[model samples]
Target chain A: MPRETSRDNMLREKHGKEIDDIISRYPVRRSALLPLLYLAQREQGYVTEAAMKEIAQILKLTPPQVYETITFYTMLNLKPVGKFHIQVCKSLMCALVGSDQLVGWFHAKLGIKPGETTPDKLFTLSVVECLGACGTGPMMQINDDYYERLTEQKVDQILSDLKKTGACPLKSGPFMWPEARSAK
Target chain B: MPKHELILLKNMMTPGYTGSLKDYEKTGGYQALKKVVGKVQPADVTQLVMKSGLRGRGGAGFPTGVKWNFLPKDYKGPKYLCCNADESEPGTFKDRQLMERDPHQVLEGIAIAAYAIGAESSYIYIRGEFVLGAHILDKAVAEAQQAGYLGKNVLGSGANIQIYVHRGAGAYICGEETALLESLEGKRGLPRVKPPFPATSGLYGKPTVVNNVETLANLPHIVNRGPEWFAAIGSAPKSTGTRIFCVSGHVKNPGNYEVPMGITLRELIFEHAGGMRSDKKLKAIIPGGASAPFLTEQHLDVKLDFESVAQAGSMLGSGGVTVMEEGTSMVWAALRLMEFFFHESCGKCSPCREGSSWLTQTVRRILAKRGRMEDIETLKQLCQNIAGRTICAFGDAEVAPIMSTLQYWRHEYEELIREAEAHREKELPMAAARH
Candidate 1:
């Protein structure tokens, strides 16, 4: 946590134009901190010290200011994680409809629990707060896609598919309810 | 059942409407924006929204039109309107559906709001977890800009309205308006004190107006069909327009149901949501989102409006009706929701930061059969100290589950403690017998 191993700007060389454009969107330069942190994370799997320092320099704040913002958010990881990050919802709606069992299957198959990464670095599992997909309980968001209404079979299929091809074609929902009536 | 027409989500539930700009334009979207801009006085638009009696759909239920009027009339600098799309509350998915299915509806709504407030720019503060919804809104914004609906000189009305999509990095407290402003400023999402409430000074210290996703989405409708039309739909005198209730938990058909505001909770659960998921008797309901207190079976017949739900001693917050069946444990349920509050407390205030931890530990101990008889009293006391003691409503919201559950289901807590007591008695006697 010292400045002895300090690294330089990690994003400017690659994302100069994008970074300038993002900073210009706001009146205050500090307002671009969250977006830059996201870009840093996207470039690297997790937010590194160099990237944090780079963002601080761009936003014109001290390193601690950027570090504090990083710690406040749950999505910005401090360390590198697996290729497929599995975030299971553990809130009331999902819990009532057996999200616990979904956690259990992760234990048996991946041999990992929430907040853990598999030894092979292929998957990481976390039990997160509600993802606003309450109606579709027993849901997990892998990377960018949400895998909902999950069964053990579906979980198995998703895992095998991700392991083999790094992708799954299972139905991801933001599906609406009550069949949209024929436009009268 | 009488059919109440869908206002916000008319063709959204159907497959034909793609939510694209062209698709939205065809379905009479942005026509309201076209009709109003450069033509109607900004004051007149505000007047129409005031007359419609539309309230904030995001939990607090403040009047949408009245909130717009609070901005300083002649402030010369830059004012802003922020659309809150950070829908992370447990059991609430209504905003997510509205954004993904009808991006332009929300975009058009933002444009109308910006013109009314005389702001040249607006931002949609969406949550980080809504990857798909953000992508959809980003695409829709580009499409609207290309079609001359959102950029400078929108629809040739000489109205310069630009909308930006900003994403939050996973903080539940960011949903609070003050905290949301702070988060938007690239700072930690902490709630600021009131009295200089958001209307006067907000979002980098300007006259900022923050409206929820569903609340702003109603503007185009209010402009298109007269306020009298929307005013007559709901409970009428007060809570007007249809509310999209996100029905989850043990319901047979758990999804978003858009109905008029005055429907009975019984009609929503037993009829609209297709009853219970199983044959089990329904025991409890959280009439709003996670923040609302639990209402028992006796309260089912109460009208699902803001005033009536408040009269029934619970809020009609966020319209997230989470149903729980008979076999579900109230203590465990409260514990799950409590953990969510404790984890997302933001640690800015001591009472919420510290009190949530105590409440969660106490509730967990009671549920785990390690609770003392006095733990029930401890739980009640912690909840009392936490509510109304913070910078925002989160303190009050965090305590609702604990306080409300204890009120209606004290017997459940007592029963669990009784079991623990019996176990202790058996252990003490075994040691005595050994001696």
Candidate 2:
């Protein structure tokens, strides 16, 4: 039941199968650069040259090709990220709503700027552009989930929950639904 | 409608202006070109355009005649009149409608432009997604060539003009003139630094005049109607002619509404768009396409002109109006648009390339209910760093949704934060629900 212990062994042994599935999805094998990097990062926690070369071999592309795409898109982290990756929206719309305050909160709470990981490796805070939820104003994301209608207290709760259980809970309150808000 | 006069919309939806020489001839299509072909010089054609006050319709609103005047009359280089048909603006689909309904009108305009600029060849650089429109343009071009209105001696004037349709890989940046030029040259679609503008340097480093589809469509009418008569439409003595406003989104009837430039937003949205779909109340409206800032319901009376829209802290951007009814959450809409910007960043500049993705992640996190209070201010600051600092308007374009939403509805975000705090009081673990 331990997550990393057996899952690590399974990932290590099944990494090749994952690589093949990712590579086969693209018409041009080179298009698998992002997925391959993601897999390599997922397994090794960072994109090492050896892992990149293995990805290159699997996808029939040069390491530079993979490197270029990885470097080009900001979503793929070349290095390790904190357990909780907090990306704050930093485009004009988000700024107008107060993304600056979000960044400041992260700085005050996590002690890190836009692109750096926290010293404790528990959180990595980065600033990003419009996340399309301009209506919510002043919002951010931690990994896959989005937290709308953000507030300092909610942020503290999110951090506290994340620290306790290693994951942020999905929004279940009636207020969290877009349909409910639409009716308002 | 009553004997549509000259320059721009001359052959506009006229009977049979497609790829048939006989059809075009039936409509008196090539008559203006024949009138000036050998008799009038290229400089005289430029003079006519200058006098007409035709401005570029590709969102920049630069004077069309002045742009042609910028090209060296005697330089004799590879001057090009590129018809920018890459209509990628999210809410703007008027160009597609024009090309689909009337292709010959645009071809005739291209012919006249090529002759006026002394461009031996003209290329209609289209968005690749316009497969059907491309076929129609090609067929029309062939028809025009066969009729001698293009290629060899046009109507016995001994002047030659070649029209070609070049397709572009779907990239929004290519809508930028220089980037469109770059895409035409078969390269990555990235915007070039301006100053040389397109007149001094364009296409293959030669002088090129990148004209919009609607702007080029106005040419045949300008020639037929003559300069003085053609300059008297719309509001504002300075701003001449009728403009097409594509009314879309929450409107009862969403379509291209061609009206005089001086109409109010209220008229366009109410009289033209038939008001909101459900009469549920119009919360906000994006006057231009996605890139322009939002205008709340209070600003509906603002005149729908380029200058008026700008004065109200928004733009008449491509005249693509999108209405958001009261029930719509600005946050969700901003997220959706951010996803688009992040997906279409093109990765040419650092701020836009990185900033867009970062914005998406941050917003997604907030939407996922794992957001923090400081995310709002962080988003605002991030947008500030990205806007006006990128190589192209893409960065600024990406900023419109979030900034405008916050401008009109910061309290909504605060309310969400408050709700989250209230929910926290229920003794329920908030991190378990992940939808």
Which of the numbered candidates is closest to the native, going by highest DockQ?
Answer: 1
What is the per-residue lDDT of model 1 for residues B1-435, given as tens digits with 9 covering 90 to 100? 227777888868556888888889888989989999999999889989999998999999999889999988878999999999999788888898899889999999999999999889899999998888888999999999999999899989899999999999999999999999999999999999886888899999899999999999999998999999999999988999999999999998888888999999999998888899898999999999999999999999999999999999899998999999998999999999999999999998999999999999889888887678899889888988989899899999999999999999999999998987877766665553332
Model 2 alpha-carbon miss at residue B148, Å: 1.1
Off by over 4 Å in 1: A1-7, A171-174, A178-184, B425-435
lDDT of 2 by residue, B363-414 (tens): 7766655556788898899899999998789999988888888888877766
Q: What DockQ does candidate 2 have relative to the true complex?
A: 0.02
DockQ of each: 0.63, 0.02
Residue clash pairs of candidate 1: none
Native contacts matched by each model: 0.80, 0.00
Deviation in Å, model 2, residue B313 alpha carbon: 0.9
Model 1 iRMSD vs. native? 2.9
Fraction of true A-B contacts recovered by candidate 2: 0.00
